[model samples]
Target: MQETLRRMQKKRAAGEGGFTLVELLVVVVIIGVLVAIAVPMYLNYRKGAANKSAESDVRAAVSAVEQFYTENGNKYPDDVVTPGAVGVKVTFKLGAATDGQQVATLSPGNTLVYKQLTTGTYRICGMNEDGKVVYKYESAVGGSVKKTSDANLGDCIGAAAPA
Candidate 1:
């Protein structure tokens, strides 16, 4: 029994008592499976976060426009000025900018497109950094921010909200 114990201790000292190949492979496979499940979930969460950020930007633009309207005789600004004190980057699509227009600052990659639909109505569309998610706020419909189907800003007009 003494000899057997000594032999066992010698084997452990030689690193012969470590995990077998099969045990190590099983652990690696389990880790791979966990990663496979976690990666897609993490990506989806990131996408949702980006969309929410764009929506927040659109809401900020709406607030700035509303403020301008309230302070300036209930008239909306002809075009949003860039690098304003509040909100994200804005691109006016209606026409040339007029003097004394309210400014809306822009972030590096995100963009907000503003258009005066009519004299008393306006629309603002915001795009995420990657330009994949778009959110729009239209005063004519319900003054609620909603996701838009259109991706590009060529027209700067977003589709109507789903019923």
Candidate 2:
């Protein structure tokens, strides 16, 4: 028994007790597979988040425009303006609230446009950081917000124009 224990100790000291190359390779392959699966899911989650943010911005803008119209004798603002407040990077072509027109403040990397389709109808379109999706809020469409994918900035205005 003593001799067997000594032989076993010697084998361990000779670096013969750890994982084999095949075992290590298997672990590495498993990790790679997990990473491959996780990366795309993470990227998809980020894209969905960005799209939701754009939609939120569009909704807020629609609320502000509707408020402005209601408060200012039922007329939509012709232009949007940035308030230049700290931590507010958004700019609007819609005029300032002080000018009897209120505009929504948006997150950074977002672009918003206000279109007065008619005297009583308007559309607010917003795009997020990715710029691949556009969120639109049209007053004439039952005030529902809609999302359009694979869209360009120009499409936000021209493609959705009311005939």
Candidate 3:
């Protein structure tokens, strides 16, 4: 028969035919355990999408500082931001929002920016590093954002004092 079909195609290419180093080390240990459970769940879903894009830029900077404090009556905007003003450069420029040991700030010469132990008055906030769902301006507050070690919330809202 053509030499017994060429010895059955060389005994089906010597029997096993391919993969075997214990099946390529069990597919490289199942792709290294699915990349170690998908890289810390893609780095906590990229830090919860940069903390919901920094709480939607803290409710668009508390509605642009309450519309610049109701069009410049109650004060607040010490000027500086004007450049294109939306979320004011990714949620108030950050470096942990300029710490005095930072958590948020700006004010001096930039006019009114606060955060670190803020007393800018109670208005916008966002909590959820585990203190559990807080938000303020875009609404959803009920108290409980106290996990403070400063993961950069700019101290979270006008903290109930600064008028």
Candidate 4:
């Protein structure tokens, strides 16, 4: 019985050597393929998320600017737009507006910008993840807020927004 048991154990050990190099290499290749596929997907998702975050932030900034206009005698606030008690500051600069021009263009700064086109009309721009200013919000006196552009851009002009 002992001799038979020894023979059985020797047979099992011979048949059950560790995985071959080919099997290990296959496993490594599979892992590499999976990583290659997942990395680009994850990066694209991150970029989309960043764009969405910028959009939401731009909307919030526009709302704050509207409130600022209301609080400050129907004129848009200059230099900065601070929202709520927490005081998130959106910087703004007054763009040059020639006579007979109806659209007031607001160029975005490091933060955001608010441009008063007329007595009540306003335009707001915000910075994208790339640090470029894109037109985000537009409103006329007694009108609703309109989203102007969605592309990340250098200036809010031409294809970016309505002239």
Winning candidate number (lDDT): 2
Stretches of candidate 3 above 4 Å error? 1-9, 13-18, 28-30, 48-52, 71-123, 132-163
* Residues 1-163, model 2: lDDT tens digits: 9999999999999988988999999999999999999999999997888778778888888878777777877667884422222345674535554767565768766777777776687767777766678777777886578886637545666654222
Worst 10 residues of 1 by lDDT: 80-89
lDDT (Cα, tens digit) per residue for candidate 4, span 1-163: 9999999799788886577899999999999999999999998886665455555555665666666556555666543331211124343323223311122222222244455556666665555435432435667433433345545322542223322
Cα shift from native, residue 40, model 1 (Å): 1.3
Which regions of candidate 2 are displaced past 4 Å?
1-10, 13-15, 81-88, 91-93, 159-163
Top model number, TM-score: 2
Off by over 4 Å in 4: 1-16, 79-111, 131-135, 141-154, 157-163
lDDT of 1 by residue, 44-162 (tens): 99778767866776777787787777767777776432222233444433222452355444443566767778779888877766767667788989657988777565345633331
Model 3 clashing residue pairs (backbone): 78-111, 99-102, 103-154, 107-113, 119-162, 121-158
Please give the range of 10 consecutive residues that has the lowest summed lDDT in model 3: 100-109
- The predicted structure with the larger lDDT, 2 or 3, is 2
Output the better candidate (2/3) by TM-score.
2
RMSD of 4: 9.0
- For each candidate, give its TM-score against the true structure: 0.72, 0.77, 0.37, 0.60
lDDT of 3 at 100: 18
